[model samples]
Target chain A: MDSTNGSQTLEAQAKAFFDSAPPLQNTHQITQKLDHFIQHSSANGEARRIVCVTSGGTTAPLEQRCVRYVDNFSSGHRGATSTEYFLKAGYAVIFLYRRGSFQPFCRSLPDDPLVECFEPIDELNIQVREAYSEAVKRAIVDHHAAVAGGLLLKLPFNTVFEYLQMLQLIATSMRCLGPCAMFYLAAAVSDFYVPWKDMVEHKIQSGSHILDVQLVQVPKMLSILRKDWAPLAFCVSFKLETDSNILLNKAAAALEKYKMHAVVANELTTRKEHVVFVTSGDNIIVQRDKSHSGNDLENPLIELLSERHAAYIKDSNRQV
Target chain B: MDSTNGSQTLEAQAKAFFDSAPPLQNTHQITQKLDHFIQHSSANGEARRIVCVTSGGTTAPLEQRCVRYVDNFSSGHRGATSTEYFLKAGYAVIFLYRRGSFQPFCRSLPDDPLVECFEPIDELNIQVREAYSEAVKRAIVDHHAAVAGGLLLKLPFNTVFEYLQMLQLIATSMRCLGPCAMFYLAAAVSDFYVPWKDMVEHKIQSGSHILDVQLVQVPKMLSILRKDWAPLAFCVSFKLETDSNILLNKAAAALEKYKMHAVVANELTTRKEHVVFVTSGDNIIVQRDKSHSGNDLENPLIELLSERHAAYIKDSNRQV
Candidate 1:
């Protein structure tokens, strides 16, 4: 197909995906929150650099009522950790995360922190346990400062429908920021889905010994985000593969096809230790500082991205 | 097929399922915990009534690496709430739950209670926010007492593999309790699963526009549990359906086929409001007290179950 036809086909597919999706239950509330947060961040004659960090995994429901779903694998550590680093780097962050995934500033806490980390001093009061006191105090203080200062906005999603729809909403809203906006796409979005219209209204019965399910590929939304949603925004996408051999090649292909500013590639097993940045320039490999016990891979990754974002902003200004 | 032949086939299928499955990562640790908990609960010349309450939903992994999986829908509220009620009824609980699902005592707290419900008083300490103080204190005190008093032993699982394996271990461990043991199987387990041997090792590549997955029926373990694992234990299974028309019939059939003492029939829409206890004697519908806003349906349900269990113990002793 010709380039024009290809673009039109993608546009149509994107439109159909959105049109068929069940409308988000809290669109008005979410939009209002985003508007207020963004407006506040941009107030007082300062245009704070704002980035939307997408995290966790999105589900593909086989049934409309959703008794069962296909879920992508993501603990949401990358996005949550990156959000904290971004905030520390002086950027206002909008964290679009999976509903039950990890949250920024709560990384050090236990899984059941409420029950595991607290003890009742009396009938009317509760105190953090001694072991968790430091971690809990830091988490609450840092998280409070971010939210109270209007530097962080957290919105949660569960399914592919909610994730994509919210992404479009966020991208369009961030378009007003011109070159100041960034998209950190880290969520493990579903590759295939049973479209809403094709889904069964009730839970699929288990009477059949052999259950055959047909899932259609989820339409590629990265291209649409780059071309239409927020063309001027700096977008960073991720490629996670269990096989190390095909990682960089797949990431490079994605970067070229989607026009992402950078594609972060890492083998699933080694993702926590290192990542390769596939960009227009040399492929930069960043690793955790083995010498430092407390160092995180995201710490260096965010520093490099922030530098590139600054350089991109300067170049955009020169062009203007 | 003859009953003996059918039973042999089921036993074979169960064996095959377990043989082909990957071993649980923390088998030794889990087994040790269960052994210790059960031994302690039976100590001091007074055997405590013990209930193994299985909660939450188990995942059916589509790939061996598990980048994608099928998940059953359960917020685990029923099991968690039932655990609390069971503890109140003087039953030691072995709560086998999905890893990240709701916990017994932390239900009233916010989803991200660590960051949302607490505030740092200084660099050294943190306190529960006033709005959450009462809830936090009550939850901590109750949960702490139950756990510290050796009445609640919590173990977590993620996959159907882990859940079934853990259930078997718990059942065999509790067999010594005889009529004092109860199995409250409330978890929404997967009806079908991709066998581990048949699953692909890596993340399923999304190169094709269409993905076809064939899932095999998960062998029924309820029958085995009643007949072999813990023959003297009272088992109460659950039936949840979106179609209320077939709920009672299905629950009755399950109770008969699995030889369950009772089967709880719940329609998805009104599960929290009411549930029908499909027992051999009579089916009784129990509802939350509408007059009392603070009342939970599990309160009356557990009370009724406790009374029936007491009667069952008395009958067993008479037979002995």
Candidate 2:
């Protein structure tokens, strides 16, 4: 029974191996890695679409010495939780997430040095409990990753300089992905840090001290997106407002500033509700929703994003 | 005869008591602290200037996943070792350094943290140095320093965000003092860290995997001197370059970029012989001499800095 059955099994294995494509290596590896590049295969729709997603918050130090700091309230939960929906809807996602924070939200995320905060002090001190939790989450995510239709890239940084650098670098890399779609879900960047001058030691007497920081403006790297990246690629950015009355205006200003196609504006309020305003040169509109709790109203979010973005995507059409 | 001698001794005691004054509880404390500040003052033609210095480096963790991280490149050799020259010049220096790495340096210079890095990590890994080197440096910099020139406040952080935040926050506190001078000789402000997006995870992953970092741009916080802190405050920035060729141009750009009145541009190679170009507007040009063996040269460098900068003092009419 063993020999006869084994012969049949061997024949099946041989047939499967030969029928499958050749083993990937050299140029073939590129084809293998990018095979997912065609996921939005809607035949009746006729136009293919892609989406970009950003996740995280922005913050600054509290003390003038900057040994201590504060972060805007963004758990990164909404962004990660929403990504699965974007993927299930058949859109490729360029997930730009903070280094370790995004680890649990999405496993099978690619490896990158930018996400690795090389702080030696934090290296030895990371509690085993956390490491265990991350490991377990990674295992679970990897278990399900084979069927997921998108990619996650982790980028980490202490100060804002590194953050902007990676953004510029990614804008260039996105060119290879074809005319794409973007989702700006990451929290806004921090406002300030020790001024570069004071990053050097400035003297003060031990007592009765008064410290002063002279802040310089950071160049808006986001300006490059509308000016370059998503002209052919669909782009989305975010506007977060903790202050009242400023949310929509600021979001609109941000759209004009980035010249973006759409923006997902959020508030610091307790409600899980969000008012998404899709913007362009001649068009603008707002959509409000309160479907706070569920497997995620992702299907709705995706439908809105894709439908609203259709004209822009079709207009740009395969920029590469 | 005994009564007469006792009377004279009593008179001397009264004089000493009157000069001591009261310990600083508030602004009045500045009067008491001024002597210590004045005594430590770096003397020039006249003791008209006070220089505030922050030495050492700041480090922070990437993700809050209980895995703290840090980044610090200062050896204390530059800030601590070179400070002696400034001290010998008789400038009253307010030196703020880190908890662990700068202890030996602190033993020689002055100033300690009012608060410390007190995170509940495994080993007090000292976010940069697990536990509080706190009031220890505080205890030493000035045991009597309950109050001093410019309100001396101290705080700590696990990430560069905290470090930078502290610097950003407290930096301007000194403006309340309205002091005439300040010096920045510290090193090791990491050019980068965990991206704001990844600020969540406990730890970024490991292994020789390829991870793409979508770097975001951080603002140049140091470029402050050009505006909120100019003229009233003479400012100098730094430049780090890997190659040669129009190196001075690079330094000039920094000066123009940060609006710093001056820039101490040096290459990694300048660590030893200490070659540098000190730029302050188009009017000032002092090329550093690349000659010296260890401590012998420290005195000369101070002289160069003092003499050139002395022109800015109230006593001198020179615009530099």
Candidate 3:
């Protein structure tokens, strides 16, 4: 199919999916919380720059009862760490993450962190180990401060249906912010999914027969997101590939086709150590600095993105 | 294919898989730890039972580089909680679990637990909140005690390859324990998988086309495990079905075919509320106590399983 036809089909599929899906259980509550957070943060002419950081991975359930699912590989470390940096950079963050993925400020801790860091001082008292006290204190204090100041709002989803709907709600809620709003689409979303209507509602029986699953192309929502949902927001998307030869080309194509402000291109092997930013004009390579042992690539990447966002805001104001 | 041919084919495929896959990083250390735990526990006539509790779900990677995978639905809560009860019953547990799954004694805590349960007393101090302190302390104390005494050994795996390979290693290592060893297979193991030889080595590219994935039936290793690996050990497996019609029948078939000592049958919806234990003699229905508001089904379930294990040990001793 031609690009236009493909895009049209994807958009149609998206509409169909939305129409068929039951509304998320916490839609009203999430809306209320978002409205309260945004209103409170923007009050008194101290409107903080807002960034919606999508993290982790979206799952496509093969069975309606969901005994099995297809999942992308993501720890949500990038988005979680980015949120911390964003908070440090004086921006309000809307963290939309996969359920049970990494949480912001808890990245440095162990997987079962509570079981190790805590201790029974007496019957009613538990103290953090001296070794972990400082780090734990910093994380808790920063997290509590961010929540108390209405600078961070966390929303979690498991399935693809929940993610798309939640994304739409977040975008619409942040539409009033216009140029001050940004989208860091770092989540590793599934590209194909079985439609709910076609799925079986029970555990698939296993015996001698080979199991064959047919997955329809998941509708690309980037175009709709940029064009309709939050047109004036600064948006960035990610393109992860194993082949370096086609990574840049595919990223460029995505940038033009979806009208993304910038697309981050990364290879599977070197994703942790390096990434390339594909903008309209320039291709910038961002690498982890060996000199600073503890610093991550997100620190520099976020700095560059935030600088560009500031310039975009200034330019938009000048146009107005 | 006939059953004989199918079993032969599966064994061949398993052999091929083991040959092709790279060796796990910490095999030597894990084997050493298991040997030490088992030998020490069995020494001085204070022979505590050993149980290798496989918990959580295993993922089947579609790609060789594995950007995407098929995952079974499991949080590893069953395995983790069972480990605690097993420890309480004086059985040393080898917790082979999925990475990032629930840990024993930490089940009652919230998802984003550390952030909420902790308070920064000052710049360098952190303390568990009063409400959560008691629970947190109990968990920490129990976990530490188990670890310090060498009664618990945790081994984490992500993919099906890792889980199966690790299970084989553990089973072989525990063969010396004879009737004193038990296997509690609570993990939601995937039934179908794309073989390593046939898997793509890169991320599957997305376009305007339907994706068809062919998954071969996973080899049923339970029979091989019973006959070859640990013949004298007591093995209990789980059957989680959505439909009530065929649940008991399937469990019975599994018990007979795999030579399993028992099979715990549960419906997906009522798994936490009730389970039926199917054995050679009779099917015993185990239910949660509604009168005792805070009681867990595990309390009774473990008690019954332990009694059976003790009887099996006694019978084996008498035979010897």
Candidate 4:
């Protein structure tokens, strides 16, 4: 197909996906929050850099009432850790995370921190346990500062429908920032979904020995975000594969096809240790500092991305 | 087929299912914990009543590496609330739960209590906020008491494979308790699963426009639990359906087929407000006490079940 026809086909598919989706439960509230956060962050000619860091896994509901769902694999570690780094680097972060996934500044705490890290001092008071006092204090102080200072905005999503719609809203809202906006697409979005209209209202009965489910492909929204929503925004997408052999190739393909500033490629097993930055010029391999016991891969990865974003911003200004 | 032939077929299927499944990661640790807890709870000829309460929803992994999986809908509220009542009724609880699901004594706390309910007092200290001090203190004290007093043994699982395997271990370990042992199967278990041997090792590639997944029935383990694992243990299974029309019939059928002491019939909509206890003799409808706003359906349901269990114990002693 010609380029024009391809773009049109993709546009139609994206439109259909959004048109048929069940409307988000809190679209108005979310949009208002985004607008307020964006305006506050960019207030008084500050021109502060803001990045929307998408995190965790999106679900594909099998039924309209959703007795069952297909979930992508993500603990949201990357996004959470990266959000911390971005905040530390003096950037406002809009954390679009899956509900109940990891949170920024809470990585050092236990999974059930409330139950595990605290004890009742008396009938009316509770105190953090001695062993966890330092970690808990740090997490609370840092998290409070971020949220209170209007430097962080956390939005949660569960289903693919909610994720896509929210992402579009965020991208469009951030478009006003021009090249200062960044899209850190790290969420493990579902590749396929059962359309809302076609889904069964009731839970699928288990009487049948063999169950057959047909899941249609979720529309690719990256092209739309690049071409329409926020063309000047610095975008980075991720490629996670169990097989190392095909990881970089797929990432490179994505970078070219979606016009992403860079594609982060990492094998599933080694993702925590290292990642390859697939860009137009050359592939840059970033790794966690082995000598530093507390170092995370996201630390170095975010640093590199921020540098690239800065360079891109400079180039965009030069063109203007 | 005749009863004997049917039993044989079921046995074979169950065996095949277990044989083909991947081994649990921490079987030895789980078994050791169960043994210690059971022995401690039954120490000094106390003959304490012990109930294995399975909570939350089990996942059915579509791939061996599990980048994506099918998940059942369950907040684990029923199981968690029932556990609190069982503890209050002087029963040791073996909480076999899905990881990250609701926990006993934690129902009243906010979802992210660590962040929401606490504030940093200094660099090395944290205190529960005044608004949440009472709730936090109660939860911490109660949870600590139950865990430290050897009344609650919490074991967590993720997939159906882990849930079933751990359940078998718990049951066989509890077999010596005879009538003192009980099984409260409240988890939303997956009815279908992709066999481990047939699952792809890597994450399923999403290049295809349409993905076709064929899931086979997960073998019914309730019958095996009754006849083989713990013959004398009183088992109360649960039936949760979205359609209230088929709920009672299905619960009754399950009660008869599995020879459960009772089956709790609940609809998705009204589960928090009410449930029906389907037994051999009569059906009892239990509802939350509306006169008291703090009242929960599980409180009355557990009270009734405890009374019936006491009668059952008396009958068993008379027979002995």
Candidate 5:
């Protein structure tokens, strides 16, 4: 191969995967998760209630493999679709969705459905941007191949750890919010990530379990919602389990552990039907099981939850 | 209403729409349409190209509601469905979509396409997240309402200006990206916004004119790209015109004016089919007029462009 061929190959490779961010940590990062709730014993709905739905899935950008570092199976059935339902039911929908899922989301909702599309990670000019989305969009558009190819940018590791760091910044900012709010973490965040130590330089031609990825616990996002971020925002956590009783136990435990008003727990392999127990501090409201026309169980669960939330507000208000 | 009710309602409304950022001039906006060749641009073997799609719809957040905002329409059809074709063809996809359509997106791309979602800014704690999705999960597991609701604690806005300012900050940050890209600007960007003369809050009760909307140019995101951001990115700007010939001419002119590589032009009255003209410094590739199948047009386009780009590198090297 000639010099031209060599350069073309490199450019092709770069086209396939480019490292856009500096090879070092770019700047100070923020934690974007909400803090967990405590035993404030503050009467529920004493303050106002705002529901924030994070609708979409995220992938870790990788340079060498030209494949995703992390992935998920999210239908946004609970977040965006149910969001429209909630909005139609007269809730002012402040829709914070993933930009990549915009089209599909728009298709689900009508032209005007009281919605907002929130992107992420403001740019270098983060101060200029009001939404975290604009920051993320600017970064993606600024470094497409690099980011899409899973190359690490700004932060140190290309793994989910750095991504989590970035997420923390946004989540932290959210946790600082006031009272009587709801932060819906419907996004399918990855359970595991590759430790930086288990990395190979030039694409290890052979795959191996020898690459022992020591998975330290990623920061518990929903738990933090109960602890640090919003002492006031209502926190709802989901437990996707196979064992039936464990699901209920976990759901109840989640409410206690997080000091939350509601804990949503469901069996993942129930086939098309969904039965989620909305375990709250005062009562455990298990929504009746409903099978939908579609094969997915999440949609019906969301439908039940949306109504449950409304009832929660109404009940709280009546008591007051 | 009692004092408690009044205060709670006001707080709820305030929490509903948290922060805002002022709108900056569209100084950074520019449309980069391109022109591709015919004979060379074909879907063949060995050249599987990837296209980073930003679609559906998006709203440019503002500190204040005014004529000075830009929001894109996310019809969701052209990009999302077309994406199905791309996925079937075995090409990797970086799906950037808006929020409301999350269910549709989740429904269609349920397995894995590695998508990221973003919604508009009105929602709470979306901008204030502490760490990442994990932390959020943990937060919900720990606390239900307080921490997240506390995060909803934000400085309320008295006017549209404040809202626009908040939006601008988010927009800039979310879109920081790099090259070899493609942005399908099919989202209807809003040109008009409510205006507030002086500091007085003018409430538009029953009688409000459609013309009352004080229209203003939104920040030119395209213009931003045509200039510095993604130098090598292939930006496809949409031109909705009354005349087909005029649309083509205007598109070609736009390609040159903005130094764009390709342009997707359509007659406003036409349904479904888009007469896409691919233009660049060396070649003007016209994709024959046809109904856009809900599949990936990006790969075929990428295959053509990537090969051409590869060829350009080869030829340029020969001359040297």
Candidate 6:
């Protein structure tokens, strides 16, 4: 295809995607929550920095009435943990997450989190187990405080369609914050999806032992977000790779391509312990502090990003 | 292809699958747990009837390194609920569930499950919220009793490969239980998978704008379970359909083809409220009692199945 034709076709495809896609089920409710939260956070003349942390993996359904889907690998651990850090750093957080992935604060609980962490002391009462009581209490109290103060808003998504649509709504809603708004996208988004019009409405029967599935590229929306949907917002995206050799290079390329403020490059195996921050001109490696056992890489990572975000906001204000 | 050739090829494929598939990571540990639990349960010349409740959905990885996967839709509510009922009915349960799906006692917890159900009373204490204390206590006490008494063996699986291998191990381990053992196949298993030999290694790069994926049918193992793995055990499979018209017919066909003792057929939308149990001689419709708001369909379903299992054991003894 010629360049002009390809560009027009891509633009048309993107438009069709948004037009034909099913509207998010809780759009009205989420819009109300976002409006109220933004107003509340900005009210005191000391506008709280607002950050949207997108977590977990988005699924690309194989059928309209989907029984099967292709999912990216993410437990949402990085996002959830980063959210906690962001909140602790005094930023208002919009936690856009997968419906059933890990949640902040409950990460330290047992595998059978809710049930195993509590015990019946008697017929009249249940109490948190002694071993888990301290951690559980701290998490609950801090989380409660954040929610009550209108500093945290939780929005959940399952499919790639829902995630993308909700993200657009979130971005536009935060536009009023300008450079004070931040997008920390750690969610493993699908790069390709089967269009709704092309998908079958029923469950694919097992009668055919072989199945052929065709998926078209999901139009890259990063450029659009940067150019249109909350253009002045500070954005940080992630690049996860299995190979360490290509990790930093790919992340740097993404930084240049998307004009991202920063890109966090992580290898699959060492992601929990280390990450390389790729900015316009520098690559800085950050590691979990071995001297302190409980210190997470996200603690340092968020601290650095928040500082950079603050500077970005100051610079933008001066420019304006 | 001739029928004979097709059958032979199918047999060869099944054999190759088992031979080439990765071994379960915790095979030795799981085997030891099962052996010890079985011995303890049968210690006093009275053997506890064992039920293996497989919960949640198994995911089929699209690549060898598996950054992406095809996932079956299941929250494991059926399996988790059924496990509790089986436990209450005085049966030992092997809860082989997906890693992150619902657990037996945590079902009643709020959407953000653990963190929402408790509050920090003080610096030193955490208490379950008054509104949820009673239910929480009951769940905890019952779960604790099951684990402490060696009546529950919880094993977790994630990928399709891991799930099948673990299921095989569980079935073979339960062979000694003979007619007293039961298989409750509640897990939503994927019908098709990209075989490991054919799958690409590492993440499927996003460079390919359009992606084509080919998946081969997972060899049906229900027949193998019936014929070899646990010949005398009673088995019940599930058929979850979105269409009401085909649900019962598909369930019945599964029962006949797999030589399953029963098949539970459910429609997606009404699954929480209703299920039809298809057996050799009856199609019994079971519904949640609307009058009793808290009554789960599993309570009656388990009662019926356990009674049938008891009869089967008696008949087996008579035959022996």
Distance from true location, Cα of B249 in model 4, Å = 0.9
The alpha-carbon deviation from the true structure for residue A153 of candidate 5, after best TM-score superposition, in angstroms, is 25
Docking class of 3: medium
What DockQ does each listed candidate score? 0.62, 0.02, 0.64, 0.59, 0.02, 0.58
Q: Estimate each model's TM-score.
A: 0.97, 0.38, 0.97, 0.97, 0.34, 0.96
- Local distance difference test, candidate 4: 0.91
lDDT of 5 by residue, A123-204 (tens): 2111112443443443233233322322211111223333344444444544433433555665555443333433332222
lDDT score for residue A231 of model 6: 96
Candidate 5 lDDT tens digits, B19-47: 22233344233111011111111134333
- Candidate 3 chain B — worst ten consecutive residues by lDDT sum? B1-10
Off by over 4 Å in 5: A1-49, A60-68, A92-177, A195-204, A207-212, A281-320, B1-320
Tell me the spans in candidate 3 whose CA falls farther than 4 Å from its real position: A119-126, B1-7, B20-22
What TM-score does prediction 6 earn?
0.96
- What are the Cα lDDT values of the candidates? 0.91, 0.44, 0.87, 0.91, 0.39, 0.86
lDDT of 3: 0.87
- Rank order by DockQ, top first? 3, 1, 4, 6, 2, 5
| Candidate 4 structure quality by residue, lDDT tens digits, A1-320 | 12344888888878888988999887888889999999999995769999999999999999888889999989999999999999998899999999889999998888788889987676555667889877888888888889988999999999999999999999989999999999999999999998888899998988878889999888888889999999999999999999888898899988988899999998988899999998999999999999979899988889999999999999999999
i-RMSD per candidate, Å: 3.1, 23.2, 2.4, 3.1, 29.3, 2.9
Q: Listing candidates in order, what is each one's chain A TM-score?
A: 0.96, 0.61, 0.95, 0.97, 0.52, 0.95
- Write candidate 1's Cα lDDT for A3-89 as tens digits: 244887878777778888999888888888988888999985868899999999999998898889999889999999999999999
- Residue-level lDDT for B208 in candidate 6: 71
TM-score of predicted chain B versus true chain B for each candidate: 0.96, 0.59, 0.95, 0.97, 0.48, 0.95
Residues B172-250 of candidate 3: C-alpha lDDT, one tens digit per residue: 9999999999999999988888888798887898875688899887777787789878899999999999999999999
Q: What is the TM-score of chain A in candidate 3?
A: 0.95
